[model samples]
Each structure stands twice: as structure tokens, then as C-alpha cells.
Target chain A: MDFLRRLFGGKDNSSSSAQEAKKRLQIVLINDRTDISPQLLENLRAEMIAVLTKYMDIDEPRIEMDRGHDESAVALIANIPVLRIKRGAGGTLEDRFEDNPDDRSEGKFSPRGEPPRNQNIKSRRRK
Target chain B: MGARVIVITSGKGGVGKTTSTANIAVSLAKAGKRVVAVDTDIGLRNLDMVMGLESRVVYNFIDVIEKNCKLNQALVRDKRVENLYLLPAAQTRTKDAVSPTQMSELCDQLRPDFDFVLLDCPAGIEGGFKNAAAGADEALVVTTPEVPAVRDADRIIGMLESMGKSPIRLVINRFRAMMVQNNEMLSQEDILDVLSIKLIGIVPEDDSVIKATNRGEPLTFTQNSPAALAYANIAARILGENVPLLQLDSYHSKGFVASLKKMLGF
Candidate 1:
């Protein structure tokens, strides 16, 4: 019966009202806990795109920003689709990048330890 | 030790604050502890009706605060349960009738005379809520297993925490076990996870509660009802007793098993 239900895409674990309510509440509480409004998030996304567009040609429409909370901390995560890196668009950062050798060592440019910075933006808000 | 003043509050109305207050007060008084249940819902008071002492309320707490009557004169002693008293709210007055300082002083006056002071707070996070919570050392926030109720409960819990109320606990009322089993309703664990408070009790969805309410008798007066047993366990827990939770699932298992056996023709 379980196998048949799964194959037919019938009512399963994820379809319960309890699960739906839990998901909705988890989202609502993330906002409630952080006191961050959807408008604020939208503005933050706009500002973030403005900052990122100067260095790279990003797919602005596909950009996404969200807040997440877990056991130890709340975080702001962003996903920006980069079309191409604009070389020599800003000369000052290029000059600093050439001068600072320690910024490239062991991927210390990103505070996130293991994951490379190219994939996403993760900034811890609170611990 | 002095009395522990606990305010029973839920930001949303009709989640069984009066019922829990009445039942827990009766349970505590029946255990030979001096207990008083103060109805802080000034304009729309219902604790007197739930406790079946509406006819005995000659004076209310406002009368005591206003110097119209003495404190003991305003307290209506429960005839059904000894050592239980009710400081009923005035039906004609507004929530602004009782200030926080007056409520706290009333609590101080009742503390030395009783072992438990249970303030039945009104709905909403307004003046009535602040007035009721002002006197409480601890709190028991009541909520049903619904989204709005849980959300309001979270708001109340946050306000109570900001007020420096210690040992705030939860009372999840009208919990439908069959609905929870069928994944149609939120479980107590789910509510506790969202509210993040220590659970003091979970009262099952029992029809006897309504019958008792309409008849002006609290469920704790009965011996074996599911809600009665749950309220008794809650009262015991308030007194620092380590009683286990009442098996709410067992309240419906008999009917469930009988139906299953009938369907199987066993």
C-alpha cells in the first residue's frame, strides 16, 4: 500500500495539514524573531544587487535573498546569478587585490570556512 | 512559603482560561491548600460563572481596591470546595478600573493567606492583560492547537518574559487526540516547539468540559473524566509534584479498538 501510494503520488508525508502549518509557522517565526519585514528584505536585495552589479554582470531578476535561523545563529543568505566578471570595471579594488597577498591564502577572503564564496552569500546576524 | 501568584492568560479569547483557572483552583483547594482565583477580566468576567459562584459574589475586587469593602468581604468563598475563594471581577467596570500597582498590592494581601493565587486574565495584550500579569510571579499561558491561538500565545509569552515573569509554563487546552493522530491538528510537541515554553499540562478535547461549564460546575469536581484528570495533574504539578502526564490517546483508544475489531469481525 505504501509503495502504491508513493508511485501514484497520493497523499503522503508532506501533504498533511500539520506539515503545511509547521512550514508556514517556521517561515512566519523567522520574520517574527528577527523583526525583519519582507519590504526590508526586498530593499536589502536591491542594495545587494546594486553592490554586486558594479563588479559582475549578474542576472538581477534571478537574485534571491532570505533569512534563516538554526540552533546557534540567524543568517542572511543570498543567491546571485553571475553572467560574467567585469574585468577592470573598478580600478581601486584591482589595485588592492594585487597588493594584498594574504587575502587569497586558504580562501580566507570568505568567512565561511569550507564553501567557496562564488556559490552564495552567507552572513551570520546573531549567535 | 508564600503563595505563588500565577496569571492564566491567552492573547486570544475563549481558549479556556477561566475553565483552567476554575478547575486548577478547585483541585488545589481540594488538596487542602488555601487557593484564590482572581478574575482580572473586569468588563467581561466569566470566572465566577465557571466556578459556579456568581450568586455568592456580593462584592468584587474593585470594591476592595476602591475601599468600598474589605478584602475578605470581597472574596467569595466556594461552598463546593473548602479553602477555595474567588475575587470576582466587576461586570460593570472597565479594564482600566484596576491599575498594576493596585493589582500587585491585592496579590500581596492575598499571598500570606493563600498557598496559590491564580489570576484569570482577559483576552488580548491590553490593559487588562498587563493588570492581571502585574501581580503574577509565574505564568501559565493557555492556547488551543490552532495557528492563531499559538501565534497569540507566542506574543503573550514574549510579553510575559519581558515583564520578568519567572517559570512561565504552557497549558494546551482542547487538544484533539484523534485529529492529531490523523495529522489534521497540531500536536502538543509542535506547539511547545513553536512557543518554546515548559509545558505544564495538555487538556484533551472532552465534551464533559462543556457540560460542566453550562451546568456551572468545574470538571475537577468529577472523578474520572479525561479533562478532570488532566486538570488534577496540572494542579499537582503546580504544587511541585512530579505527576506524569495523563494519557490523552488512551481516552480514545477504547472506541478506536472497538471499531477496528467490529470492522475485522473479531
Candidate 2:
């Protein structure tokens, strides 16, 4: 009976096996909870890059979303660089700027010594 | 005494939820506890087959719920073990045919008769899962060492917690100790870390399980199978016995590999 008891006994293995099991379990569950496939995330990042490029210049652009340890929902982090134009006198103070310089200055241009008409356009757009 | 209703659920299909339910109920019954295993998998009823009581089910849970038969009439007693019964699900009806309120009421009525009421929940977090969970006081989440099963187990555990259920236990089923030793599989501690639930049992993959199921008999009745002994250990734990969890290292060290390598070449 001792032989049978030893054969069926529950002895402790190294904790390494248990640790590996835990790692595999966590990775699979994280994917399952969000329903966001790895392929989908890659596609979403590409689309987000396209959308951001339409409005601003992003440096080392990256979009990362993950689930927090305790939180039940997905958390998002988006890194985007806003376009900043330095004005210089070349043609009309606008020709020296990048493409669509008017688009950038239209939203938030400080009229310290600028023309009144340009200030009027800015204020009207804000309203 | 009132029966303790436990729902054995695995959001992913075929993670041994029904098998665990059948074996656990059988183990409990063998220990002299009045147990009833209920199949809530409506259209895909297989708990009866696992328990080896398919031919004995004259009336199912639906028949009792619809008042077509008394609750006692729907319960199929197991000839293998005394004080053990099965309330099989209807293979013809879908999950929508029964409501959660009716399930809860049925369990309430069965509580006074049995010591443990095990509900074999269906796969997925759908209507069938909800109805099975509704009548359960506690839950036993079964998952394999694989990623998908563990993921679904986590989701089910979260749902059970949200329902204000306490004492939820995790059963890591179909574990291969050799593969785990070779660092190819997940271990029980790893699963507990991810699910963060109390560890109840770890069932090693045994070929006897297939043979037992084919014969419509639960493995817990077999004395030779390690998986059978594990089920009995789980039942003992449920009866408030402090049984130590099974360890794989000691068993493997004494195997032929170590002994043969110690001897001279033939």
C-alpha cells in the first residue's frame, strides 16, 4: 500500500512550472477581455497615424492601448505632435511656411501686432 | 441541511466543466453525501453521458420546470453510488426555454434533500450560462493550462464576482505534469496568479477518463486512476477536509527513467 500511496501522492514540483502556467494564462486573458486582436490593434495604429498626420506632425509617432491591472476597460495613450510654424519674411510672411500655413494660423494666432482683418478672421472662426 | 449549489463553468467550450461536475458529484456521493448534478446545457446535454446515467433520465429539468413532472421524477438516481442523482437537461429545447427565476426556485426546492447540488454550466457567457449561474450559490471555474481557457475562466470569474458570489474556486483541469516539468505547459500556481482565485483542485490528464466516460461511468468510482483520486480529494476538501494539493515531482522522480539511468547499460 505504501507503493500505491507514493505513486498517487501529490508532491511539490519546482515553482517554475506554476509560474509558466500563470504567464500563459495572463497573456491569453488580456487578449480575451478587450476583444481587440493583435492584428486589429496594428490596423488601428496605422489608421490613427493617418488621422493624426492630417492635422499635425508627430515625432516618433506611436499609439499604445492596454488594460490596467485592476481596471476592467482598455486604456489608451496617443502621442501626437502639433505643428508649430516660425514666421519669416520671404514672400508674404506665409510663402516661407509649410503647406497649408493658413490652416494652422487660423485657430490660435496671437494678434500682438498683426493686421486687424487677420484678427477678425481668427475671432470669427473661434465663435 | 440545505444543499450547496455550485455552478461549474468554463466560458470556453470543452474545458472539462461537465466532466468535473459529474466526477465531483460522484465523489461526494461516494463519500455518503446526498448529491445532485444538474445539466444546464439545454440543447447540448452531455452531463448525463458523462455520469453514465443517460438511459435513466426519464424526465429532464425542463419537464420539471414546466410542471410536466415532479422534481423528484426528473431526478435520475445513479446506480453506481447511493444518495446521488442527476437532473439532466432537455436535448430538444434550447436555452431560452427556461428562465433563471425558475431554475432558482427549482434549486431552492432541491436544497433540503441534497447535501451538494452541482450545476454543469454550458460554454460561453450567454443565456444558458446566466440561467445556470442564477441558481448557484458558489462557482467552480474550470480551465485548462492553455491561454484561451484561462482567459474565459477569468471573464467568468469576474462575472461571478459581480453577482456578489463568494468562495469561488478554480480547478485547473487536464494538466500534464511531464510537459509542465519540461517547461512546455502552465502550472497551477501560474493559473492562480492570473485568476487570483482560491485553488481547489488540479486534475491531471488521464486516459482512464476517456474509458470511464465511454462506459458512461464517472472516474471517481475507479480506484486506480490518479484523476479519480484527485476528484475524491476535491470532494474531501469540499467536505471541509484539509487535503494537500497533488504534487508531480515526487511521482516522476521514482519513475523508470531515474532508476534505469542509475543502473549499468544492458
Candidate 3:
């Protein structure tokens, strides 16, 4: 069924509505799932900087929650810089992605391990 | 056996949730199954207008929940289809007027008499959505080929999953075959891949849908229109029938041409 549609409908309009919708939906859904709205993330980042400055000397802290290939296991990887270590929790947030974020054995988010998403667009534009 | 409670919801507005609820309920009723569609979008109710039962709506759903009227008294039977009915939402009251417990209890009361109870969930994953989804055994999430609707549908599907709803399905509405063929709109496969849920229906973009809404008619009859054909197919699928989706390439042009030739005796 798909083979037939691709053979006929896939010939012209390779940039068809079908492909556009899929790409747009992927980005939009990933963003929604990640729940890192730009405004909200910005406010959190500001607060994190302010609260951290009150405690100790720190470098730039980047809060990035990247959407992995898997739909459910989006990652929230925060790079918090501190000159001194704090005592309390034994394990760290840095090693969280070592295990599967979701129950799926297949690692959901590549955590800077997988290939980038825009390779297709970049190649298409070059052509 | 008790009726199957199915809720039709789309987190985003203007994606044919009410339209699908009305038409599918009518189609099921036309097929001899007793069906009642509940309008849960109180205050911004459109199901009454879409089903063309606005004139007959004396008692809304809130009335029944509030015990102001009997359940049957609030139910408006369709003039065109026997055994098909509507439980309308209140025009003045808000969605908060009805609780999840009340809605589910109402559905339980209607279960023995009907084969299907269709709940029309309001737009957004807020109070109205929870109230409508509360009584449903399954969910039919509606979305268009656009990005925002798909995004919201994904969110709604996640919410449904968290609520432990089984067999969540997708209904792609306002689909343009030409756009899909041209790679301009999202195809069924693309939507399925992104949403990763089972697709139950794919309705084509037809002007007749708007016309039917204006006339308070549902496009679920055996019409030449593609949208009606899709709805009829969906209605059958909902009855647990093993129906395959329309073979697009053949049904789009070749089948029509062949049927036309047969009609002309050429």
C-alpha cells in the first residue's frame, strides 16, 4: 500500500504536505513533550543563576533538555558549574542517562550520542 | 450487554470533534445500533448546531446532572434516525457545572439502553476534557494534517495513556488527498508514525461537510462525497468489523472511473 502511494504520489511534489506535516509534527511534539517552553525555561535559568550565585562561585550553567529519538524518554541534562561539591545525595544527575530513561531497553535519548536530526534538510538544501 | 462508551476529543479547537461525534453516532444508529452523543462542551456548545437539534433542545445535559429534568427528558431524539439521540450541553452553564463522577454515572444510567455512548469532549486538555473522558471506555482522538493539532493530539494521547485508557485511536479529519499525493499535507502513514497509535478513520477535506453543518445534517449517509464514505467506513470499523481502509490510489480515481463506465454501459 505504501509502496504504491510512494511510486505514484511520491514522484512529483517530493516536498508534499505529507512530509511537511510529519516533520512539523515531529518537532512540535518533541518540543511539547520536552516541556521546555522558551519563556518558562528562560525564567528557570535566571532563577537557577540567582540561587546558585548566593551559595558559591559558579560558571555559566546551561539547562538543556533535548528530545531524543524516543517519544517518551526526553532528557533534562543540566550542566551546573560549582567550584566545590555539595554534600547530601550520593549519586549525581550527570550519570542518569547511563540507564534507559524509559522502560524500553533501547536507549531513548542519545544524549549527544546519536546523529543529528537536520541532516536531511541540510543535504536537501545543498542539492 | 452494556453500551460501549467512546469519547471523541482533540486538545485543540476547530478540528471536527463535534462533527465526528455527531456523524459517527448517526451512522451507528442508522446501522441499527442505539447511539447517543453527549455534548460536553458546555457554554461553547456546537454539537447541538452541528447535529441540527438545537431547536428541539429544551433540557440540556446539565439539567439531567442537576436533577432538574429526567435523563430521557434531557435527551433529544433525532427526527431523521430512529434510536439515535443527543444529550446537549448547557448554553449558559460552564463545563465545571458537571463533574467526572456525575458524567460517568450518567453514562452508566444510559448504558443498558444504548449500544454506544459518544462523548464530545471540548477543546483543550482542561476541565472539559477530564469530564468528557471520565466516562469513556475508549478514546477517539481527532486531529487534522496540521502541526498544532498533531502536537495537541500527542499531548492528549499522553494524558489518556496516563489515565490508563485502553485502545486509544486516531481519527484524521479534513485530510486532502491531493495535498498528500503532492507531499503538501500530512499523509495517514506520516500521522500514524508520529502519533504511533492506531488510525481508525481518515476523512477527506470536503466542502459538503460545511454544507451539512449548515443544514444540521451529518455527512454519514451513502453519499458520493469522500467524507461521508470515510465516516461510514469508520462507523463500521467501530462496530468491531475487520474493515480495511479505502485503497487510496484505486478509490481516488480508477475505481470511480470504472464505476462511471459501468453506469454508462460503455
Clashes of 3: 7
**Candidate 2 TM-score for chain A:** 0.34
lDDT per residue for candidate 1 within B66-180, as digits (tens), equals 9999999999998887899999999999998879999999999999999999999999999999999999999999999998898888788888988999999999999877778
Model 2, position A123, has a per-residue lDDT of 11
> Candidate 3: where are CA atoms >4 Å away?
A1-18, A35-75, A78-127, B249-266
Q: Candidate 1 lDDT, tens digit per residue, A1-127?
A: 8999979977775578976676667666655556566776776676567567757899988887877767444678888889999875556644755877555454433333233334233221221
* True-vs-predicted CA distance for residue A80, candidate 2, Å: 9.7
Instruction: For residues A1-127, write the lDDT of model 2, one tens digit per residue.
Output: 6577559984445455556556655555654555445666566666556544543466534434543443332355555555532333224334433555564456322234343232111110001
iRMSD for every model: 3.5, 11.0, 7.7
Q: Model 1 chain B: which ten-residue window has the lowest total lDDT?
A: B257-266
Cα-based lDDT for every prediction: 0.84, 0.78, 0.79
Question: Over 4 Å off in model 1, which ranges?
Answer: A1-14, A36-127, B247-266
By lDDT, the better pick of 1 and 2 is 1
Tens digit of per-residue lDDT, candidate 3, span B95-150: 78988999899899999999999999999988999999999999999999888888
Clashes of 1: 0
Candidate 2 DockQ category? acceptable
